[model samples]
Target: MTITIRSALMKNFLGDSPDWYKWVIISFLLLNPLVFFLVSPFVAGWLLVVQFIFTLAMALKCYPLQPGGLLAIEATLIGMTSPAHIGEEIANNLEVLLLLIFMVAGIYFMKQLLLFLFTKLLLSIRSKMLLSLAFCGAAAFLSAFLDALTVIAVVISVGTGFYAIYYNVVAKQADNNSQIADDSLIDNPEHQQIMEQFRSFLRSLLMHAGIGTALGGVMTMVGEPQNLIIAKNAGWGFVEFFLHMTPVTLPVFVCGLLVCLLVERFRLFDYGTKLPEPVREVLKEFDRKASAKRNRQDKVKLVIQALVGVWLVVALAFHLAEVGLIGLSVIILVTSFCGVTDEHDIGKAFQEALPFTALLTVFFTVVAIIIEQQLFSPVIQFVLQAPPSTQISLFYLFNGLLSSVSDNVFVGTVYINEARAALEQGLISLKQFEMLAVAINTGTNLPSVATPNGQAAFLFLLTSSLAPLLRISYGRMVWMALPYTLVLTLVGLLCVHYALVPVTEWLTQWNWISPPSLNVISSVTAH
Candidate 1:
């Protein structure tokens, strides 16, 4: 009986995950303490980060929250980081937490409208290249004002909806023909190939859209969370912030669009997969049925959601309230008038965002460990100690490297604070400070697209329901994003190194930027 119970418990652990994966997680649990005790806490902290990333990389096998949370709990219990520090990290990023919780849920409620619009887009745009460009361009434009996560959530919903519509059609046909007994149709080779082609097509568009978020996400103060932090420290308003980033962002944005075209033109990196005709027919039929079945009430709901979307854009652009609060207001308005008062119905909206939100909290725990261990301090110190002439480029490059491996927001926050401290000590002039602030903002935003771990949008997409169905994994995402990452990072770095100083000089002469010496500011402005 004892042996049977032990077997049951082992079987219950990480249910359905491969036995090897289960053992790997178990080994990670056992190894952390030994490394923490016998080795330096710093090494142990870095090890924990890598272990958490391993969980993320194997996300298709099991959710990262369970395994990553286990590591986080162990790290805290072993005194690598305290609960208080974790709480502090969460507190520092409370706005982002709220955005994930409320904003993404709010987006969930708008899926009907999103699906309707995107279906039309898919059918109308016959060219795969144009369709890809549209997805990328639209995401970029939306992300410039709305949160990147929110924009991606919308895309994920639309993509999943698109996938579901066609998948049901295929499954039903397969069932009628009795060619495949399974629901997935994996046994039917022809349908399997068609599905694979469709998945590839969707995957490419999703990747382009993901990169698009990064492209536009660097343009404004509200683009990314860290953009606001850097803007506040540099004392730049919206127009000034936009102006400051234009030197780097504009060039990168143009190059990014061109890269989008080139990749599709050459069918590089698994892009340019034309939408399979069967899948297109399925989507077209679904769109036709949807449009035909639309009643006045349904039309009103779409209109309401559309108006709310407009309100969302305007609200975020004007900084009317904290992002999450605006998102809450959206939830209230949409649910109140759209005839969705049922508890279960509203609760369904939370399903998509809550898991990722929990994972984000786990991410903060890892960030807390980084803080306690000062793992990034040496990099911070190195950049700060670099010569002034080269400091901007160094800050840009190092922030990019660190952000690619860690959370970009955390990396940006730390570097900006350090740069502000330098400003206070008169080590760097306000002119140089403004330049560094730009570097940090662009650095964290542009280059961090290299991996899912680097950008929250990419991470969200990787862990999202759409990822597994589309066969998008961590390595796959890195592979797809390679071209955009290269173009954005290289263009951004060159512009920062060569174009930034000249642009700043021109802005200063135009009185758009005040000369640091003429303005005797006491210290960097705190957010």
Candidate 2:
């Protein structure tokens, strides 16, 4: 009886994850506190950070929340980071939290509109390369003005919808229609092959669209959460922010599009998988049936969602309110007019974002540990101490490398604050500060695409239901993003190294951008 009880308890831990994984997590929990006491807290803190990232990398084996949360709880108990500091981190990032909670849910209510539009586009575009470009270009454009998370949510919705359409068709053809959730139900080798092909097709498009968000996201203040943080520190308004980034961001953006084309054209890094014809036919039939069944009320709902999407774009463009509040407005407007009043129905919308929100909160605990430990301080000091001629490129390179492993928003916040502090002490010229600010923005946004954890959108997609369905593990995502990551990081580095100074001078010469004003700097620094 004792043995049975112990076995049951072990089985219950992490709920069907691999036994090795459960043991690894158990080991992590046991290791953190011992290291904290026997070793320096700083060393233990870095170890915890690596462990947290390990959990994230193994996200496909189990959700990061359970294992990562356990680590966080252990950290707090061991005095690596206090609950107070964790709360402070969460409080500081409340806006981003709200955006995830509400904006993603708001977009959930509009999935039908997204599916309708994307299905049409999918059906119309026969050329895989052209379709890839459309996905990349549209994602970039949307992410430029709207939130990357929201744009990625839309893409995920479309991917899920398309997958379901083909999945059901395949399941029915296999005479296992009731087992829709199980991929193993399709015993026929041909059906299984088509399914694999379909997954590859979706994977390519998703990679393109994901990279698109990064390409356009670095271009404007509203493109990323960190971009706004950098802009505020530098006293840049929306237009000024856009102009400031144009030197590096514009060239990087063009190069990014070109990379997309070259990869798709050459079929590099799993990019050229064409949508299987049978799956396309299934999607077409599903769309036809869906269209035929659509009533006037359904049409009205689509129209309402379209209008709300417009509002989402405009509100975000104008900085109408905190993004979360705007997202809440979208939720109220979308659900109320769309006739989705049931409590259960509305609750389904929260399913996608809530888990991610919880994971993000847990992520803040790790960030708190970093803060309490000052793990990044030495690197910041090294960069700051470098000569002015070498400082810009170092800042860009270090920021990119750090952001690839850590949260870009946190990395940007820390570096930008240090830069602002230097300026306040009159250590660097205002012009040099401006250059550093742009480098920080581009650095954080561009190369962080190397890992799922580097960008919130990538992390969100990694944890979404869609990733598992598409077989997009962390390693697969990294592999697929390699070309874009290399191109974006290398191009961004060169532009920062060579083009930024001359381009900024020209922009200033033509009055396209203003030199940093001492008065503005002083006033901002005063607060």
Candidate 3:
């Protein structure tokens, strides 16, 4: 009897331990998100808790936890896997989703408006190449200063809008069959209404604009992602940054133009319509509306131009003085408020950045941690060790391929850091490095619209804004991008080789005596 009683007690004790353990896990899960509000302590949740338990149980049951290289991964896994309050997990994930949504929305909305204006300008000017070149120049400059994504968003929007107006309003009025189609369609149509009126030729031209803007981004350190990473990692300043990247940018742009021209020939198949009369009518409308509304648009443009000019000056000053991005932003903001741009707009820009900034920073920080841990060092080093020419060539190829897998910005940031390391280590010089930057930057963008999974915010933005008027399709966009990609890659390759490579090779060869610290390890650590 005594033995039976003792057995019962033991069973109860064992069952109680599990109950207690589960309760404790539940408590931690609940408290995890709350920890973010607390500066003093670290708590984690999400499916993290569940994963942690599994990892711990498996590791303990199956193997030993070793210290060293894998420790960081182990820590991350553990923290991320640890059980958390389901509520907290949901909330955190929701925040991330919201951030991503905002980022996508901001870019799309901004691009639509910009595109509208560019189309207006094109209608007034009626020269696709001219518009394209101007756009490319602006894109290149902006990419060199602000981030490429932002520049692209703005430029693409303008391109889309400019043509939209010309086609939807301006082109239709002047077209040959347009009047009959409009009258018949409204009264009683026999055949489908032909909507082509604006410069259908310019449709292909808009494709070139994207190509040019993307190519231009490769020209300078500030132009795109990989370059920025390279600058920071390679300890490059402005003069050095541009000098190094020119090899890639120059060739890429030149070749890109040729390709764009060629590709545009195929785009000419879009022979849907010609210069319409309505485009001018619409411009007149815009002018009247704008003038009546205190001529806000014209005034805004003037202010925008001046602010941009000042922004550049202030940015350069900061760079020269090494005052950093903060100083530049302050200068831009102060000057932007000078009877031109509204303070509200400036604030909006900053606020707009906030949505994704923190999340992106965290992601990069984690990646950086991984690098510091040396787990990622091997892969990066392997890529760096490849010939600069090969790296430049392969960078575009791989970037284009992988762009279908992730966000262009994400790919860009990773590539930049990796390329920077290569530059610093002498695996690639600055010029060679820039060549790779250009290739990858352009590559990432074209493929972004390859599918829903790959589609970027810009793609959606374009569709939503213009679908009502132009009736472009998802399939059409993909098909359109195909010709774009083919021409762009070919032209981009040519441009990089022609413009940047020779100079880069010369510089690299001359600097050989100093023997660049080809190994990124030395720079990051005291070793």
Candidate 4:
């Protein structure tokens, strides 16, 4: 009886995951406190950061939130980071939290409209290359104005819908043939190969679209949450922020589109998988049936969602309200007008966003630990000690390197605060400060696409319900994003070193950027 009870307890603790994973997590938890005492709190904190990333990398095997949150709780208890510090991190990023919670859910409610529009594009565009370009361009445009994660959510939904339609048709066909085994349909060699090809096709387009987000996301103040933070610290409004980023962002944007075209045309980096003809037929037939069944009311709902989507874009572009608030308004307007009135239906909308929101909060705890440990201080200090002539480019390179591994928002927040301190102390001129601000924004946004770990949107897409079905793993994402990463980072570096510096100097010489007056300095110092 005693042995049976122990076995049941172990089983309960392990749940559905493998026992080895449970032991691995337990080891991570056990090893941290020992490291904290044996080495140093700083060393232990760094170890914890590494362990948290390990959990994220193994996300397909187990949800990272459980183990990551456990690590966070252990860190607090062991004095690596205080509960108060974690709370402070959360408070500092409340806008981001609200955006994830409400904006994602808002996009969920708009799926009918999104699906309708994407379905039309998929059906009308016969050329695979053109369709890929359309996806990339549309994703870039939307991400420029809306949140990247929200835009990716729409893309994922469309991909998932198409896969479901194809699979359902395949399943029905298998049922009609006795030679095909329903249980082995996914595992059959020929069928699996075709599915793999289809997945590769989806993976390529999704990567293009994901990279598109990064391209447009660096263009404006509202393109990313970190951009807003940097902009606010610099005392720049919407227009000023746009003008500041334009020097680097615009050229990078053009180069990014060209890279998209080149990659598809040359079929490089695991791209160029054409859609299987049978699957294409399945999707086309599905669209036809869906269209034939649509009535006047269905058309009206699509129209209503379109109007609400337009409103969302306009509101975000004008900085009408906090993004989260605008997203909340979108939810109310779309649901009420489009007849999504049932409480259960609304509850379903929250399903996709809430888990990610919780994971984001857990991420803040890890960031809190980084703060308590001062892990990034040495790097920031070293960069600040560089000559003023090279500081902007160094800032860009440092930010890109760090943001590729850590959270960009946290990195941006820390660097901007440090830069602002330098400005207040008269260590850098206002022109230099503005240039560093641009570097911070573009740095954090652009190079972070090298891995999903760098960007919240990429990570969200990697861990979404769609990823497993599409066979997109962490390593796979890195490989797929490689070409884009090389192009964007190189182009961004060149623009910063050569183009941005010269343009800013020209603007300053022409009085386009006024010297820092006392009032301006005071305002910056006060903030």
Candidate 5:
């Protein structure tokens, strides 16, 4: 086949002088992280298409490799010509994860407005302590559950206005309200020299929020996409998902509340002096506004209150009714529209959402196709064929790692599908999968905080969000998150192990089926 192609090329002219180096460069460039984190979010299988085209161009068109050698071997592995699609598959998982994030963002906005109303209502009562804690707690909890990026988008007072808009506008508002001694930095060049410093600060804040969401996601399927991916892969849908996640979410919510509050409360950032006097004054003023904002938020509060109450029930209806993503989104739109408790309040929820929203839905379509085709079949095959324990361990480990640069929800679901396929084909067992899902899913939260690549994390990094306000960091996040990760993972691993692994006969004799006693959770090995 090669000889014939070469002969034809020679006859056709110029083929004998093809630039082989171009192929090598193509291979390297196509491997860029842009696919996993960037293009996939917007165009779905576009990244996979890049991979395949590069592989083919390098191998066949460029003919850079010999007939049979090390280069040939590498080419074979790299030359993924399958109609199957690893890139799209990965992307699809990301889409589902994005959906959950949508809910997170939607809910975050709801929370802010509602909290504002609540605080306002408390004006005649104990609005000081209780109202403040209540609003902050509500914000933190949502941040943990849906990815803090959701909260950051609407909060523009730097850290204080972490839920506002036009941060510059808020800054001007603060300038007007606060009685600052007028720092010269607003007119000085020294403070403005390092744009990177500003960016890094934002990145740090996002990292914390990312960690929060990833951890929070474990609490419920709506927390993020990985849960849905796992459920879909298992063919168990909503009931199964809620069953697996709710118990974990409730405990994590407590953990999340403390972490978010303590971190913000302690003002670990420069004893709360990192921000300028003007900035500080602005934040305090906004808190007052936020308090005032909550007072008028009655309609929003009612809608969200009902949303929390009916979230699980409404989600399950999608499954019982056998509707897909479009159907589910429609349900959300319709219900939200019909229930327009505060038509005058929350603004148009899905207005700016449609473009990003379309991007999400179509992107998943591409992902579904890739999974169907198995462009990544070779690697996936290796992972699935490994010993069940090894596969499970790798799944969770990779889940944690990739989530740093990519969406964990997408990565985890892909792992879930691979694990499920293995189990159904008798390559592994359901019991093994159950444990694997818990370990991997629970660990998925770490990546959310480690990097700004995540959808939730990225939004959190907006110049106006907490990233600049808090000055978070990659290194700092690891330290901040280690305790949470170790605690959550250990508890999660054991819960999953109990669920997936058969109880030893001796243990069963003790009537130990009560969801692993609290002592049992605490005793699990962090390592």
Candidate 6:
């Protein structure tokens, strides 16, 4: 009886994960204290970070929140970090938390509009290459002015809605065929092949859009949360930020679209799957029925959503308020006008965003541990000691490598603060400081595309409900992003090394940037 109870408890610990994996997690927890006592808290803290990443990499097997949260709890108890430190980290990143909560749910109300637009595009475009380019381009445009995760939420909703419609049609056909013969719909090899092809097609388009977000998210202050932080520290306004980033981001943006086209044209990295004819017919019929059934009220709802989407863009462009607050306003406006007032309907919108919100807080806890242990201090010190001529390139490479494994926002914050300190102490010139700031922003933004672990947007997509349905796994996402990663990283490095200084000089000459003697750094680095 005792043995049976113990086995049951073990089984309940990681629910459905393999027992070997469960033991591994348990061993990690058990070994941390020993390492803390014998080796050092620094080594132990690094081990905990590695263990947490392991959970994230295995996200398909289990959601990382529960296991990762457990590790966070252990870290706090063992003095790697304190509860107060975690709370402080959360306070520092509260805007991101609110953005995850309200913006994602806000986009939920606009799915009908997104689906209708994408559906029309899908039916109108015959060339798969053009279609891929359109998805990637539109996603990039939207992500530049809005949140990347919110843009992805819209994309995922459209893809999932399409899949659900086709799935239901197939199910109905299978049910009807059961009454006629043994060759049912599910038993047909050709039908199965078509379904697989359809899945591949959606997977490619989704991956393209996901990469598009990264490409555009590096371009402007509003493109990412960390961009805002970097801009605040540098005292750059919207136009200044855009001009500074254009040297790197604009080139990468064009190259990214070209890569999208070339990959589809050559069928590289699982990209060239065409929509099967049968599935296309089903989608066409569905779209036709949807169009025919649309009434005056449906048209009004779509128009309202379109207007609100425009407002979202304008508000963000002007920096009207916090992005999260604007998202909240969008939610209130769209839902109140679109007849989504029911308690149940509103609750459903929160379902997708809330889980990811919880997971993000857990991530902050790990970031707190990193901060408490000074895990990245040595790298920052090494970069600061490099020759001034090569520091920009070195900072870019260092940031990219660390951001690939850790949170880009945290990496950007730490590096920028260090650079600001150096500037304040007169260790670096004002001109050099500006160049390094650009390097930090572009570095954290561009190269983190190598893995979902680095960017919150990628992680949100990987953990989304659409990922499992579309058959997009962690390894698959990494493989698909390889081309974009290489292109953006190399191009961005060259720009940082050569173009950054010249661009700053030109901007200063044109009276667009403040002169070096103005003490503008005091105002910009206030945060």
Which candidate leads in TM-score?
6
TM-score of each: 0.83, 0.85, 0.59, 0.86, 0.55, 0.87
The Cα RMSD of model 6 versus the native structure comes to 3.7
The C-alpha RMSD of each candidate to the native structure, in angstroms, is 4.2, 3.6, 13.5, 3.9, 12.3, 3.7
| Model 3 lDDT tens row, 1-527 | 35687667644542433554444444544554454245311223222223332322322122112111122244344443222332232232332233233322333223423444554555565544455555545555544554444655564445444444334442334434333323333322311232343434434444444444455555554444444444444445566666665555455556555554444334443522333444556656755665577556555644554554465545543464432343344335434443436556545544434544443433343344333334335556666667766666667666666555444554565565566555556666644555665566556654443432233333333444433334455555456556545655565455444554666567778872122345233433421
Candidate 5, superposed: residue stretches over 4 Å from native? 1-149, 152-210, 237-239, 246-348, 351-391, 462-466, 469-527
**lDDT digits (tens) for residues 341-376 of candidate 6:** 899998887887787778778877887787789776
TM-score of 1: 0.83
lDDT for position 9 in model 2: 89
Off by over 4 Å in 3: 1-120, 127-206, 269-273, 288-314, 321-346, 365-396, 415-457, 460-464, 467-469, 491-502, 508-527
Which ranges in model 6 have alpha carbons more than 4 Å from their true place?
1-3, 164-184, 237-239, 406-410, 417-434, 455-473, 511-527
Error of 1 at 65 (Å): 3.5
lDDT, candidates in the order shown: 0.82, 0.83, 0.46, 0.80, 0.45, 0.80
| Candidate 1: pairs in clash | none
- The segments of candidate 1 whose C-alpha lies over 4 angstroms from its true place after superposition are 1-62, 78-82, 163-199, 221-241, 276-282, 405-410, 413-434, 459-475, 504-527
- lDDT by residue for model 4 (309-358), tens: 99988887677888788889999999999988999998887887787678
Q: Where does candidate 2 stray beyond 4 Å?
A: 1-39, 77-84, 167-196, 235-238, 276-279, 405-410, 417-431, 453-475, 505-527
Give the worst 10-residue stretch by lDDT in candidate 1: 174-183
Runs in model 4 deviating more than 4 A are 1-21, 34-39, 170-183, 186-197, 276-278, 417-430, 505-527
lDDT of 5 by residue, 1-527 (tens): 45787566544542443545444444544543444345442232335534433332233243222211222223224432222443445453554545543454355344434444433432323322233334445444554334344554533333343322224433343434232222332443543333234334334344344454455446555455556665455444454444555444456556644554454456442211122333335445656775565543555555655565355346543454432343345335534643554654434554434444443343343345445545445665776777765665556566666665555544565566655555556666555556566656765764344444333444334333243344554445455555445555555444433433443223335643223222222222210
In model 1, state the lDDT of residue 158.
80
Q: Tell me how far the alpha carbon of residue 386 in candidate 6 is from the true structure, in angstroms, after superposition.
A: 0.7
Worst 10 residues of 2 by lDDT: 172-181
| Pairs with steric clashes in candidate 4 | none
Instruction: Tell me the lDDT of model 1 at 90.
Output: 76
Q: lDDT by residue for model 1 over 173-203, one digit each (tens)?
A: 5314223224456557888899889889999
